[model samples]
Target: MAFEKGGENAYDVVIIGAGISGINFGYRLQERNPDLSYIILDGRHEMGGTWSLFQYPGIRSDSDLYTFGFPWRPWTEETSIAGGPLILNYLKESAQMYGIDKKILFHHQVNAANYSSEHKTWSFDVTANKTEKKTFRSKFVLLCTGYYDYHEPLKTVIPGIDDFKGKVIHPQFWPKDLDYANKNVVIVGSGATSVTVVPAMSRTASHVTMLQRSPSYILSTPSEDALERFIRRWFPVYYQHKLIRWKWIAVPFLLVTFCQYFPSLGKKMFRSATEPQLPPTVSYSPNFTPDYNPFEQRVCFCPDADFYRALRSGKASVETGVIEKVTADSVKLTSGKELHPDIIVTATGLKVRVGGGIDVSVDGKPYNVPEKYVWKGVMLQDLPNAAFVIGYVDASWTLGADATAQMICRMLNQMKKEGVDEIIPRLSDKEKNTMKDAPLLRLKSTYVKKGKDVLPKAADRGQWQARSYYWKDYLLAHYGDIKSSIEWNRS
Candidate 1:
């Protein structure tokens, strides 16, 4: 099971970061084109990506399992929103079922990739377990590294944080032995992570307080889908799964579209759904209300309204204020209030690293990653025989991953048929000038806003643009003409 270092590796394709996106892409590539030789590499010694990295208590999918699960895999669990351990197990099961685990090289961290125009191959410099360095060569390089930095969690600099005496933690690097039972815990930030951890920690923590600068719109759903359960009882398993998957997928798409086009109406409906869950003393206007419209930022999902129940039962509370300073025993707020806590969980945000923080060059020149436009939402502009799988922000991450796989497989198969060695996506001069500039990711989440500039750009329209809608992306990936945006060359 141990992947040893010191050998020079070569393959038809080299996939970096064997996470959800990487595993899905590798599985599809191997399934579609059996003749192609590929290897999946990860810095971590496991197959599951985010699922493996995150170990915070009560950590579950922000989205439902039906949509979050891979298209090829049927999520047979009764709960639609599964915890981290279950998700990790599902990913591992997927790897074993598709034989992707055998093709994966664990502890292989990609440092840089250099593409040669004349040789038509990518050369990689990789480090294994931070000790041994080795070279790898492949006809193409596929990056499936998720956006967040795995080596270090994004830590925010709070004034006087060094003076704090309490145990501080980031959800990304939750300690295995740190116990919080019967302790006062103050969780910073109002994102999905904060909401999730608040309800979970309140169960044992003497008091859990969620401190936020601004509120994220929170919604709740049943952990297990009753309709899905009913369908499973009456229908064939495969048919039921497919039906539930498509239904869940479509509902999100419709919700996103509705919010996008009708912001006011969407906001009103969101507040209505949230109001009944709040305690009588708590107002939904300021703390629970968001200034941004729905889908601009992702709506936080609290399964079965446990977060609300926790708040109502006085186990946890929410505070909206900026942190002025952190003292030895408490955190001072701008509103002239101080919070005393035994523990502080700074779920501030994630630090986004484009292309897995790996340097990329083309023919001895540094590749300008942020300057390139997305080609059909998957491949970067002017990048030859390379693609990076980034999933949907609006839907499940795997939805975009699956679409990217389908598109890449089609492109690869076409190149094989035409005897082409390189395929590069190019934006015409007119296309570049005519197109309007937009952020690489449409979501206005805190983590995204902080790291948007370093990421790639997207055009206003056409095949070169990026979209979060799964149905549209799925159709384009399967049926869109590859010749329109890319130039195929034999050299």
Candidate 2:
């Protein structure tokens, strides 16, 4: 269906962000509800969201591309793990192929959204090109802005960092022209970004050190999938994609389930797998071993054991301790040890921001996002004609986003058929008071803990709970009660 440009100020749906979730939702919205007029609004000049923003060395997806790719479009690349450029190309291709790119309005940032109870419409205060002000109205709003703050990263106070004479960098905004060749580099943090940068920078730097306050669970996997290749060669082309995608999905799901259920055994399994990859000098306990169980925080995947190989090559090393202070040219550890480096890279983590930091109001009154609840992990409690997408932490993020798109599409269709103008996830004051609050993200990571108050409240059960499993969410989206806890109106 060709989308003719409708009115400049109004639409049936307004999808904020032209990133992975927005693109997926756009495709699903078109395929499922072609009659609805919608437009995608992105603050950035381009698509691909995180993939487009981060240009750090060795930037790649920790999850395999098979599951990370869209369900309608399969990832047929030889390597399961993909770099940033390749993934960006795939997203652009997918958007263009499905005509999603045409519906996107770049340089349009939504600063505030106000929902009217009488009209049952959302009026968005948008800034175009960071200057011109505009208003766009829509019956429904989809917040595909993702979970993190794009402009600012999580700030960690490194003692005496300001006094460091060497070049300091954050992985979030890597300088394009910065050179580290033949220079000693120290990466602060042991997250996915740090692990990726260590191996990637080690190839050019004279020496790369991974400085961490504590250890994290890191596992290695094959970059190329021989089994997937074998299946593709033998199976029919029609079933090949589904098989490969499910294979990737099920494997991770089972592994995470095992880890959650049997943490001790899971720890043992990870330790056994990692012990052989480590250099003889580096012990598994002090560097590779995490105090928490596997999957408690995300498990960093080192494709083809590139990280371990870098360590074995003597170009990269890990240091586990607290930083006492930072000198002009060296970092002092609390263990009374010091190391000199030419550069320091902060790979701490991201700061979580819900609804792309847009100020949301209802009927001219401010909406407290943190005080409200999330219904079915898609729509917010007491918010009419709106939904948001947040992906899975344990598995591929696309899976959860796709499920949310499907559910929202189904709800919109139902509302249309029933002649309802507005649909809100309603909960009584008593129920809200009695329900136990739960964290939306079930990770023990520092970023998740610090940004808890920014997100919406969640319950332990019922439609108010935050569901993570893709399969279960898919089932619920397709067949579960769409009217549960929902209030409908014809305004």
Clash pairs, candidate 2, are: none
Choose the strongest candidate by lDDT: 2
Count clashing residue pairs per candidate: 0, 0
Query: Looking at model 1, which ten-residue stretch has the lowest summed lDDT?
Result: 1-10
For model 1, residues 1-491, the per-residue Cα lDDT tens digits are 01122335878889998888888888898789788888888888887888888889898898888888887888988777889899989989998998999999998888889999988888899998889998998888889998878877776888998899989899999999989999999999998899899999999999999998989989888866678778888998769989888888888889888999999999889988998998886778678888889988878898899999999989899888899999999999999999999999999988988788898999979999888899888899888889987787778888888898898988888888888889899988788778898767878887888787778888778777776578778888888778987888875
Model 2: per-residue Cα lDDT at residue 71: 92
Task: Quote the positional error of residue 82 for candidate 2 in Å.
Answer: 0.4
Show model 1 residue runs off by greater than 4 Å. 1-8
TM-score list, all predictions: 0.96, 0.98
lDDT of each: 0.86, 0.92
In candidate 2, what are the lDDT values of residues 1-491, reduced to their tens digit? 11223677789999999999999999999999999999999999999999999999999998999989999988978788899999999999999999999999999999999998877789999999999999999989999999999999999999999999999999999999999999999999999999899999999999999999998888898976788779878999988889888899899999999999999999999989999998987778789878899998999999999999999999999999999999998999999999899999999999999999999999999998998889999999888889999999899899999999999999888887888888999997677678898889889999999999898988987789987798899998999888878898774
Residue 441, model 2: lDDT of: 88
lDDT of 2 at 286: 87
